[model samples]
Target chain A: MFKLIESDAPQRRRICEIFVDGEPCQAMIGEPLAAALLKANCVPMRYTPVSGAPRAPLCMMGVCFECLVEVDGTPNVQACATPVREGMHVRLIHGARSIGQLGGAAQ
Target chain B: MSTFDVVVIGAGPSGITAALTAANRGLRTALIDEQLSPGGQIYRNVDAVDNGMQTILGPEYLHGRTLTTRLQHSTVTRIQGASVWQISDDLEIAYLQAGVSKTLSARHLILATGAMERPSPMPGWTLPGVMNAGAAQIMMKTAAAVPSGDVVLVGDGPLLLLVGKQLLDAGASIKGLIQTSPIAQAGKAMRHLPKALLAPGYLIKGLRLLTHLRAGRVPFFRTDEAVNILGSDRVRGVSFIHKGQRIELTVDTVLLHHGVIPNVQITRMLRLEHRWDVDQQTWKPCCDGHGRSSNPSITICGDGAGIAGALAAEASGAIAGLDACFALGNLSEGERQKLVRRPARAHRRQLRIRPFLDTLYRAPEWLSAPLDETVVCRCEEVTAGQIREMARLGCKGPNQTKFFSRSGMGPCQGRMCGLTVSSILAAENGVSIEETGYYRIRPPLKPIPLLALSQARVARSAGTERNSQPNEDPTHE
Candidate 1:
């Protein structure tokens, strides 16, 4: 009987220290960065802080800038698009003043 | 409602040839495309250092420079970044450019809109670090940006191999090339190999990539399947089942491709007769020996008819050009045929290689489809299980699946999951993929915000008010 065994390769796991409260947190290397942040149970990487549009990585093609976290003081860096590098500091940009009130895009 | 002797839609191989040929024959011609510059998706150019405009169009398409330069000086108007929203049976086109929508009419229309990248679905396809091979090429060739430093190339057919080499040249390290088909299947596909190798340089180019893979010690994994793309926010790695063993490789980017499909949304909207090509996985506008389409007012040539690559597209474009000239009373039938003879031969050769290429990459059915748990539309987090349930509940087609399961209804629309969902529907219903048809693409085709659309209208009106000479034809000398 040819039986398939469960391989040791981990399919989904997270790396820690992505960003929290608009500040850079140390992230773990060689793990899923998003999962680690979620495991740590941080409420949000970025928020509207006023209208409170809770945004996360969506459509992932860099097309939708949802999971944008300020990296190395650069605001609006796509967290899902940008790979974590060693010693890379990440910060979350939040606040109603920080995220200006932009209305629905004119269709 | 400005009328022209001929209108060539899409400035790709087919469109360029049609425009150049018709313009040279002294016909008032217009060439339209979506990019900011000439050369369609294939021969894209980035920055203009001098008037030269360092072009990155493929080797086969490099010869387009002569034709493009001639077109630059000709009476033909090259309109760039123009989105053709709708084409009517009466040869009316509604297009938008620089933020304004305008309607144009033509006596004769040639739809050389060319082919698009086939829809490929995976767990994290909609995620930020993933892109189609065409998009990757555009980013590298047009935008002068590499998606990632380390990339894993997947899928089969010529572009996967070719683009991997190109990415390497563009300063990206291809971790490996994972071919879905086994080596044995490749042997079967080899019978139709002569068609691809018919040209003087085609075989050499393919062989060059293989040689480079060997010489540079690049790793290639055949008979493998990428089970899941592991990442939460961005692409972190890919897990595959290679010959019954699971192996996961961590990488920053994943370049997904399954060859090319006909860019026929505009054709479909116009209600032109089209036939589904099984092997190439695309819809081609039905045309006769002289490239006359069902509309009679419209003609189609090149890969938009089918995936035969650039050379065939060039030949088909020429055929369409000659046919347009004949219809415009500029050339006799005999003269047209004589002019198109060489190109017809080239197109025939393109058709020949397709069977071999199809067999070689015949996507192991499983690659496009995964288990119930595997996510198809990563944007909406729609899983295969959810789609199957929706289909069971009478979601008959991709449109319905989109409506119910939100499979093809995302920010990317159905460009990424349309084919896969269609394939799944066909498989569930026990039908052919061709019968399923691709997704419906509407205006503002590249997903511009509604704000951008309104702004575009304002810009167009202002530009007209300024009354400056239209500089839309950047390809012009």
Candidate 2:
């Protein structure tokens, strides 16, 4: 797993726990959720809807949406753009996201 | 709605410099950016990057610290972490921040939106482990993390070499450095060496990077092309042709980069006239020597105007800022000219080595026109084959292809695939990429939730009576 280089600069680490695919993972408080996941060796953040192929964050700058994952029940959240918070819930997106109630007929 | 004399659309070096200049000229200025900090991508998190990483990023990045500090002290109002969605003809900007949609008006707009790594779409590029070299650098800059395991650097350009050297310096195992520039180009590239040496610092720095790589004994391959990425679910290996012989390297991570192209979404949305730069092989807004666009009210500076690197970007920003001041009657014509003299000369000098660099790292035509099976748009899963088929079936342009196959209609709004699609259409239709055109950018440039839009409208409506005349001329007073 990739870890940050130990720096002589004073460490301002903010420890927090986040749930990834139902597993509890430790993360920095304000670090990008995607970076934290990669540090934990979480490859294949999601599966492409078209081919059911695994994909991970390519551009951590949020230009590429390869790191899209469901965060706290919100679908299509860019993990690279979103920051990690305490008790944040992140779910690995599987193949072909469903549109949910937004696509359903009005009741 | 809040109004200002100038609204700089990005907080990078150019945008910050513009804002600082405008504010120093006593114009009400507003600077908006999507990142939480100022410094854009090149010097991202300049203030927060640890000293250890500082040594890795080099002095160019340290320059951002001074710009950021000046911006913080200036009178310009900074709205960080805001995504600008729409820009109107009358210089009105609609943006979303913290789930609140807001609109601001400016008499003049300076777009310093900067650049994105040119899309290198190849076989297996869509795999998980394949990423842009710039992306990897961003991770290192922002997160202080480097990719573990065997990482292979691919493609051409200064960034490829710089990142390879950085990763090796950081004690990461690199499998190889695959250069896509044909070996013969080196002889041609040297023809401009005398002119390039005029900017001795850049040439020396580049030479130093190359020397370091050689000293590290990093296996370098002058491959004719990066033909394919060999992987099933993730990047397992990469295949390229070196001297008419196929070679393969097994690796866990593959970082690719060709060069950078202007992020022209905002400028295109504003419908400003853009000219295709043949040497750079990208479409950039038509701006004058001082960064004034075809539309007098709008100006484009920095890499968004053209790829002239950071120093040129800052110089352009200063010129645009002074020009905007003169336009707003804040500075007299004589004073503006006198102020811009230094920056103008510096900007010209910074552009001295561009011809040499452009020739040395010209992206091969095949990289732009990827193999038919390679996926062009990752958002919509549109492939080169599908785009070509659409072109053959009388698809006039990218917009038509969008309807037929949904190529640029994804969350990225064609940022990732626009250039590739245009190149394919141009090649198939026997026209220049300029004639092929780009995706028609519309409102809501960044994704905003439905709830936010409604709430913003309601809040604005409530304040309409108090600040009703958002379009009122600020100079009239």
For candidate 2 chain B, the 10 contiguous residues with the lowest summed lDDT are B457-466
lDDT per residue for candidate 2 within A6-66, as digits (tens), equals 6786367566899998899988776778888888888877887777878888778868888
| lDDT by residue (tens digit), candidate 2, B1-477 | 799999999989899998999999889999999888899998888887755688888887888999999988889999998988776556667788866888888898889999989888989998888889988888778778888878888888888889988888887788888888666667888998898989748888888999999899889887765468998877888888877788888898999998988998888877779988988999999988889988899888899999998888898899989989988888888998899999899888999999899889988878888888899999889999999999999986899999999899987889899999999999998888888899988767777877776665332221113355778542231
Candidate 1, CAPRI quality class derived from DockQ: incorrect
- List pairs with backbone clashes in candidate 2: none
lDDT of 1 by residue, B1-477 (tens): 577889998887789888888988899899987655667667754222111112323545466566567667788888876766555435666676644666677889998877766666665665445656655554444323444446887787778777676666555667877777656777887777766576546667777877866665668776455447777655688888776777787887677777777766666556567786666555677888867888777788877777778777888888898899998889997898788889888778766666777777776667556677766664466777887888688766777777776665654556556656777777776667666665655443444334435543222221112335667432221
Chain A only: TM-score of every candidate?
Answer: 0.53, 0.85
Q: Relative to the true structure, how large is the alpha-carbon lDDT of every model?
A: 0.63, 0.84
Name the regions of candidate 2 deviating beyond 4 angstroms. A99-107, B458-477
- Each prediction's TM-score against the native? 0.75, 0.93
What DockQ does every candidate get?
0.05, 0.60
Best by lDDT: 2
Q: After TM-score superposition, what is the CA distance of residue B260 in candidate 1 from its true location, in Å?
A: 1.1
